[model samples]
Target: MIKHELAKLVEIAAREAQSKDLIPPTALPEVSVERPQNPEHGDYASTMALKLARAARMNPMVIASAIVSSFPPIPGVEDITVVAPGFINFRLTDNWLREQVPVILGAGASYGSLDIGKGQRVQIEFVSANPTGPLHVGNGRGAMLGNALANILAAAGYSVEKEYYVNDAGSQIEVFSNSLHARYLQALGKDVAFPESGYGGQYMIEVGQELATEYGEKYLDQPSQLGAIGLERMLDMIRVDLANLGVVFDSWFRESSIYKEGKYQAIMDLLKEKGYVAEREGALWFTSTSLGDDKDNVLVRTTGVPTYFAADAAYHYDKLAERGFDRAINIWGADHLGHVSRLKAALTGMGIDHQRLNVIIMQLVTLKRGAEAVRLSKRTGDIITLREVLEEVGADACRFFFLSRSADSQMDFDLELAKQQSNENPVYYVQYAHARIASILDLAKDRDIDFSDGDVSLLATEAELELIRQMILLPEVIEMSAHNLEPHHLPHYAQELAAAFHSFYTVCRVVSEDIPMTKARLKLVQATKIGLARTLALMGMTVPESM
Candidate 1:
């Protein structure tokens, strides 16, 4: 919000300078206001003058000075100066920074909320991992990423829905069904051999045994019935695993439903009508090359079976047109990277804005025990399950570490480090800051120090002001994260905020004999607690009051 306000101020100053004939009457460019990396430069800096220098044919310093001279006085701005290399810097008053303590305290849990979205509808589909297998640590990355992004969008005032798209009608499901049936026959002591293309995870055997124990020979004559039972069991397992990782989808959209409801056929007809579909060698193609794709993609194979691309196009149409979400965000794994462009082209062929669909490709996650890489589950002999990681560390640590890196970057999850209880663990370190604040607040309460009317103006120490500075960045951080669709920023920002609080606590006494100073410091810590807790909550991590 401060950055926006400062950017507006710079625009106004530039226009005013233009009117005064101090600069050429060129059209105003987009203004950018960013924080100076160096502390001494100022709180916020702008390069509008430097950007205009080329067009105005004037020295950048002269332009900066002219703009600063014409800059209107805005509250909370302590000083505006023109630095070398044509940068206009604006510093916030320390009094204004300290004044935000009461504001943050007053806002409570809603401190970082912004209205940037204005209640637009957004549906985020993530971790739609096939029900054929258990979710591994890799799927956990996309799960946390989508959940956290939904939180950020909601905090920014968007109506958000988390969805899990069930690929229940695909080739993978058919294979899984065959595998389950084979195992079910084996469970009945039949001489059926396992399908070569069958799933090899031990969970499949358990499902088979459970099916045999539950329904016996009734399903031995019915492979479809056995497959349906196994599919339901696998979905139940996936749901429990996601719940353990702190992710719950608001909707479970079954891919089979589209065909059952005739939406899939409807989409195919629409694409054909739009001239985006063509028949080639008994196969139906999407003709994506018309939309600038390097090659055409198949909508249906020569075997008359529709491809996954065709099903996804129908699903997206349902999401944006029938369901009427303003935006649809899909969080997929790296393997689905090839689907991104074709899906967008499909949307375009459907008379929808391709920009409305955003697909984020989350890279792989490698689980480690100290320095050694651990890939397979000790129990299932498959990729290590997210449930196993959650059981070992916790939902909180899993969410924190899964969201620590950008979705585009591969990350190694250190199991031994996550299990640590000390400050060496980031989630522990951040939560400890909140716990420390709680103890300080308890100390104030025990001493009968009434901070209800704490004077924020008395908070002038560098540590106090620095802590306040970090506390107020929450709104900016939320806005930036929402704008960029990057939830990774929240975890990093939480760590920085916690570090600022720890630094403040080490140098300043909160329950000192000086009642006035103690009251002010207590209020500061209380504000920090609110901000730190909110950040952790947004990242889907638990904030411990005492640890």
Candidate 2:
């Protein structure tokens, strides 16, 4: 809403300048209204004058003064000042900001929901970890990021579908199946050499035991032939593990199913129709270089099996065309960074709009226990599971920690810090603030106070205003997070809002002997609770009424 107001101001100034013949009609510079990093620069600042000065070939100060004089008084603007270097600053009325308290409370949970997405269908596919073992720490980061992004997009008015792409057709599944069979043979006291590339995690032993219990010694005699059935059973166990970790997939898209249903061949046919495929080296190759890939890619090997790229290309085609999604976002780990250009090339070569595909590469996460790092290797059965981390720090803290950092940056998961009972942990700090407000509100309710009839104007302290400002800007923050496809901003914004609320609680007396101010303070407190609750709810976390 503030951005809209600022855009209006810029347009008015641009028209006024054009009318005065100071600049040509078509030479009006693009104006940007940005919040200043420093509060002293006023609520919003525009550099239109500096931009127009270059085209007008005049002094920036003169242009700035002219624009300021031509500007009409806005209702919420306390004052408009022209600063040096042709920057026009606008200060907002404190009273107008304070009046937003009731508006926010009136909107309730729906206050921050915006229509920026315009009802476009968006599919966010993330944490599609191979159904081989329990989800490790690396997979948890993607899960939290994807789930939070989905919630943020929905709040910003997107028709969101959360999906998980299962790698049920890959060689990885063979390895998992062989591993289970080996574990079973070992459990039966048979002399069997474990496959060199097989998984060796202890969880596979459980899968083997479960298989033995279900069908005792039936599949063991036919190791090679039983792989298909064993793979299916192993995937079932993996699904159960993921559900236990609070990671649910709306669609478990099977890679093999895509190929089996002829979607893979259809995609190849479309690419050939678009003249993007060619035969080379006794294998079918995709000419991805034309679309900005580093080189051409192999779509099918000499063995006649389609490569992973072929399956992904077909999967994306189905997602975009047949599924009719307006956008598709893939949350991938850091190792997949090199695949971005190739995937984009594949989409482009297939005549699909490249803009429809958005790949977010989340940097790797390193988990530490105190000063020592936790080493994880699935082959050696030496990895930390997400379940273990969740058990240690808690789901709320684990989600908060993972969601707090940007996906582009590597994050250190400090087990010791997360497990601490002190305020050093950000999750506890924010939850404590919510609990503190609830405590105060409970106290007020017990005193038979009627806070519904309070005068919000009594909340005149700087800290109170700061808190109100944060609460009013909740929608804007959500909009930013959604547009950028980044949920890290949510936790950071929550912490800032909590800080403001805590400062207000410390300085403002909510249950004073003076009844008028006390009622007003109670109203402010209730509004804060509404905001904190909504903030936590946005991240899919519940605000405990009592902490």
Candidate 3:
């Protein structure tokens, strides 16, 4: 990765300082390498001089100049300069940037793979929507975030698993079942009153109507098992909705199974043994306050029924302790913000490192058609279902818009923009670049011109070199995104890569007057195609050869 390479350069500077006795030779400070926000500054910048000046008791510029002057030559590095405020900047030469074309072509799909995670196991749990009804468009945001993170982590050499925790045994399922039963009775011309807490979605009514037709009046008196039947059907529907959104779970873990398999009791016993459990007001409480929580949380009610927190504690225990995963991540909606500190405390109380658990809260999403805001589903009349939106635009477009903003910020998705085939639609714009490149190469093949042995060193135009620079940053982008657990950067990076390719096409002719130049430019175009394809695949979207 470029960041790692830059760190090595800084280490060289540090060693030079040590050998000259500019600083203490016996001790060296940890080095931090970062990219400059302004491109004119340099490719990469380091501020170790400013950090070390006070300790060395010397002028910042003197320390910075010493480090820059003593640094040995690095390949592809044009010059190392000390800038204002004692910042060291490194710029790559044009030759080095041009030489990356063959490196990109040689690596192909594996261009951005890194070994940062060092093969540690990570589990990403997301979109675990209660299997009581169809998934809403709100749920789609979490799916896109989690799936993309999984792909990024795997590329960074982490053993990652994508999972969905099914809340099948929750109270929502009970209400959903009773609603279905009442609807079934109402459809059969019975005079039963609908329960106040029943699910009033059109989908639930349709399911009840189907049951009425399948076994007419058979479940009228004894509809006790209707909840189980409805839960399974909802689960099947949820699976289809996720697949439509281009997401797949490696495992579907059922919450009900945890209690049946004895893991729930095992966790509870572990907590009680550790003296983290106590009775308060006739209910068993977890001593979360002892670990910095606002108050204690109830593990079991006075009626002896386990709470969701109990199941959640057991689920996390199974993930880190039983399954032996090094890290666990849960993607939740913004409403779960209050649950973070307690969950962390619970994990620490159980003896596992709480820092290993990460909870990301995704803000809400609102769909807009034009000047008006769209909320209710025209079909369901209550919530906008994920399937409805996916079917309306496309899986590719839906995912692109969902990831356009950071997880912590609210987003307004423009429905009309998503359907547009113009550059206004970001997904369409990126895919068109890939398709345009394919057309150019196809035309080249008709004239018996091959790019496999083209002279890549001849690519010297500013556009060509800029495109090459952007292409080489894919590996660096992946490393940064994975390290920070943020995916909003991918969509932005894809647009930049696509724009670079488009700018290059407009300025440099690939099949022009100079045959050798044409051949060299073709190789550069081919490298661009590989970079675009790899990015689209990483986002779990289709790589359309012709859009």
Candidate 4:
């Protein structure tokens, strides 16, 4: 809201300059309102004057003075001062920041929510790891990021749907089925060599044992159709495993269903109608280069099997057209980065708006125990599953660690750090702050203190003001995270808020000897509790009342 007011002021200044013929009417400089790193620059600063001065061939200080003169008197802005190099610094009235406390307490859990999306229907597809094996640590990162993004969007007033695209019609599923079959053969005392490229994890043996118990070697001697049945059962097990990990999908879109329901053919027909498809070298090719791709891509190989790109293109078409979603977001691993350009080009060729498709490529995650690295390669049959990580660290710590950094940056998941219960772990630090506030509230209730009669103006300590300022900025942080599609900012913001509250608690006592100061500090503690609880809720973590 403060940023909006500043932008309005800049717009008015730009208009005044244009009317005076000092700058071209069409050459309005880009304006931005940001908090300066040093507080001495004031609460908010803008560089519009410097930007316009260069264009208008005027002195920077003179341009800044002109813009400041054009701004009308506003309620919250105490003073607008021009500094060196044409920077306009704005000092906000302290009362305005203080007034936000009651408003935050009143809004409670809904304080940071905004109607930015206007209830538009949007769908996010993520962590669609093939249901061939357990979800590993690598897949868990995307799961956490996608889940948090969906939550943020929903909080921002979007009709959000979280989906998982199940790859149930691929060679990977067949290999899993064969792996189970080999394990079954070994259990029946028959000599059978495992396929060279088949999955060899110990979990496959469990699937084989379960199959043996259910059918009692009945389907083992049957035809290859039994393998199809075995694969279906394996996928069901995989889904159960994912559900146990708290990753539930609104829709389990199977690749097989897309082909069986004629959607794949319909997408190919749509591309053909658009004249983007051509026959070359006995294969069907998509003219992606015409749409700004590096080269044309093969949609269907000479063997009549569609490539992965073809399946993906068809899936996206269904998401946008048939589903009637306003936006579609795909959460992919870093290995899938090369596919972004081709997919964007395919969407352009299919007559779909390119902006509607958003692909987020999350960098790789490395798991470690203390100083030693853990090897996790599925191809080599050495992998650390998500279940193992969750079992070792915990769901809360795992989620917190995964979301503690930007998605594009490589993450080092240290098992020792996460397992530690000390303040060194960020999750514990935030949770402790919440628990401390709860303790104070419990004490207040026992002492029969009435916080309603508190005088808010009594809270004048620097740390107390800083805590209030952090609480007031929750709405801004939520908006930024939602617009940038980054949830890592949430935990980082929470840590800063906790630090502010902790410093205030250390210096200012809530149960002081003076009743007036005690009651005022009680209100402050209540506000901190609400903010900390809200932040934890956004990350899908519970704030233990007595952690």
Candidate 5:
């Protein structure tokens, strides 16, 4: 909000220059106010003068001076100055920074809420790992991204629905069933050849053993039924893994559900009627090149079986047409980036706007422990499960580490650093800041210090002001994350906020010898606590009252 106010001031200055014939009367450019990376420059900086100089036929320095002279008085701005290349820098008054404490205290958890979404219906489907095995660390990244995105969107005023699209009716499920069948036969002491494409995880063997224990050799001849039972058991495991990581889906949309409910066939028929589908070589083909795809895609193979693309496209159609969500977002691994455009094209062919369907391709994740690549799970398998890493570091640390990086960039999560209690671990550092502030607040309460009417004006130190500045940026962070559909900004912002609080704690003691200063700093500490808790909540992380 301070940034917007600064932009308005720049516009007013531009208008005054126009009235005085100092510049042309053309429409003004949108002013962008950015915080200078160097603290010496000031609180906010704008480069409008340089943008206007060419059109106005005047030196940017002269124009900046003219605008500065005509600038009207504003309450929070302590000082304004023009520097090299006609950049205007603004410094906030100490009173204004101090006033934010009560505002923050009063706002509490709802401080960062925005109305950008206007209650639009949004569905974020993520961590839809097949019902084959437990969730791996790669799928864990998508889990964190989707759940945090839903939280951010809800804070931005959208009606968000968290979904997990289960690929229950596909080759993956078939292979999983066969794998379980083989394991069951083996558990029955019958030799069987393993399917080369089947899952070889030890969990498959466990599922097979369970099946054998539950039903002996009854399912030996009914192997298809055995696979279906195994699928349900596998899904149960996946659900538990997700729940342990603080993720719960509002909907578990089954790929088979679309077909069972007739939605899939209806959508395919609609595509055919719209001439977007063609039958070639006894297979149903989607004319994707009709909407700018590189090649046409097959919807059904010659064997009369639908492709995974068909199920995915049908699922999206259900979200956009049958269920009627305004937006549908799918969090998929980067290995499926090639599937994005064709899916969007299919949506376009169905008379739905392609923009409504958003597929976020998450890059790969590599786990590391003390600089060594951790490729194998502690379990008897090569793939590391999400539950294993979560148990090693912690659910909070795992989620924080996954959300710390952009979904499009590959990230290496360090199991060693995540478990550290020192400030080297970012999650620990942020949580410790919350715990320290809580201790300070409790101390104030124990000392019988009355802070209801504390003099906020006493917070005049540079560290205190900087901390206040960072505290107020939470709303902006939410708004930016909502607009960009990226939640990585939250973890980085939390770290900076924690650093500001840490610096303030070092310089300005909250429970100090001076009672008046202590009460004022107590209010500041309480405000910081609110901010840190809100940041943690946004990322679905817990804020421990004590470390």
Candidate 6:
């Protein structure tokens, strides 16, 4: 929020300079206020003058000075200086920074809440992996990314809904059905060849055996019915797997519902009416090339079966147009990268703004055990499932490691490191900071010290001020992550905040003989606890009171 406030100051100064004819009347560019990496530079810095120099036909330094002259004095702003090359730096008074401890304490868990989204309805659909098997480790990455984004966006004041779009009706399902049928017949002592392309995971065989036990010969001939039952079993496993990883969707939307409710046909009809649908080679095609795609995509095959693209178009249409979401964010795997442009084109064909549909393509994750690569699951003999990882590293470490990198970057998950109960692991390091603070608070409580009347003005140590500086940036971090659709920032910020608190703890002694100083430092430590816990919570990671 301070960044926004600084940006507003720059904007007002620019307008004042323009009105007085001190600078050319050019429309202002976006005011960018950023924290200077070096504290000596200032608390916050902006380069608006440098950005306007070329357009205004004036020296940047002169422009900066003019803007500063027009800038009004703001409380808590200790000084505003125009540095070389036209950098406008703003520094906050230490007293003002210290005063924020009580404010953070007052806000508690909601300290970082912002109003950037202004109540826009945003639907985040992720980890909708086909309902054929358990969620692999790769799906875990998308799950954490989506869940964290939903948390941060909601904190940034957006009405957010997390959803999982189930692909229960497709060729994949057909293959799974055949596979289950073959296993069922085998379970019943009937020799039958398994489908060549059927799911080969051991879990599928287990499901088949369970199905045989539940219904003997009643579904022996009903492949479709057996398939339906098997699909529900797979979904149940997927739900449990995701739940263990701490990901619960607000809704589970079935793909079959689109066709059952006639939305698929309605969308096709509308596309045809808009001239975006065409018939060629005995197949219905979407003319996406006209809307900037590389080529047209098939909507319906020659056999009269609708393609997956058709179902996806209808699903997104329902999400954005019918259900009334202001925006729909779909987190997908790297394999679906090619479908992005065509899907946007399809949305455009249906008279919807393609920009409203945001697709995040997450790269693959390579699980590792120190120097060795981990690929197979001990139980399924397939790619490792999310449940396996969660059971090994626990949910907090799983979520932390999954979200440590941007969604677009391929990451390696080090199993050995994640399970380590030491500072070498980032998640452990951050949680240890919270646990340490909790211990200090407990010590203070045992000593019968009341920090209720703590005066924040007495806090002035470098470490204490630095910790407060880090704590106050939580709101800005939430807003920035939500605005950029980058949830990775939360984890990185948590580490930085933890490091700051650890530095403060090393130098400052809480519950000392100096009662007033003890109370003030305890209040600062409590504020850090709130900030750290909130950051961890936003990433769907747990805050452990004791390591």
* RMSD of every prediction: 2.2, 2.4, 2.5, 2.5, 2.4, 2.3
Q: Which candidate should be chosen as best, given TM-score against the real structure?
A: 1
State residue 113's C-alpha deviation in candidate 1, in Å: 1.0
- Residue-level lDDT of model 3, residues 85-130, one tens digit each, is 8999988899988888998889888888889999999999999988
- The C-alpha lDDT values of all candidates are 0.89, 0.82, 0.86, 0.83, 0.87, 0.90
Candidate 1 residues 276-385, lDDT tens each?
99999999999999998888999999999999999999999999999999999999888788999999999999999999998888887788888989774423345668
Task: Give the lDDT of residue 13 in candidate 2.
Answer: 79
Q: Taking the candidates one at a time, how many backbone clashes does each contain?
A: 0, 0, 0, 0, 0, 0
- Residue 26 alpha-carbon offset, candidate 2, angstroms: 6.6
Q: Sort by TM-score, best first: what order?
A: 1, 6, 5, 3, 2, 4
Error of 3 at 452 (Å): 1.9
Which candidate tops lDDT?
A: 6
Model 3 segments beyond 4 Å from truth?
A: 23-29, 222-224, 367-381, 414-423
Q: Model 5, stretches more than 4 Å misplaced?
A: 368-381, 413-423
Tens-digit lDDT track for model 2 on 164-283? 888888677777778888987777767888888788888777767776777788887766455666666656756665565455677878898897899998998899988888999899
Question: How do the residues 511-532 of candidate 5 rate in per-residue lDDT, one tens digit apiece?
Answer: 8789888888888888899999
Least accurate stretch of 10 residues (summed lDDT) in model 2?
238-247
Model 2 stretches astray by more than 4 angstroms? 22-26, 222-247, 370-373, 420-423
Of 2 and 6, the candidate ahead on lDDT is: 6
Stretch of 10 with least lDDT, candidate 1:
375-384
**What's the TM-score of each model vs. the native?**
0.95, 0.93, 0.94, 0.93, 0.94, 0.95
TM-score of 3: 0.94
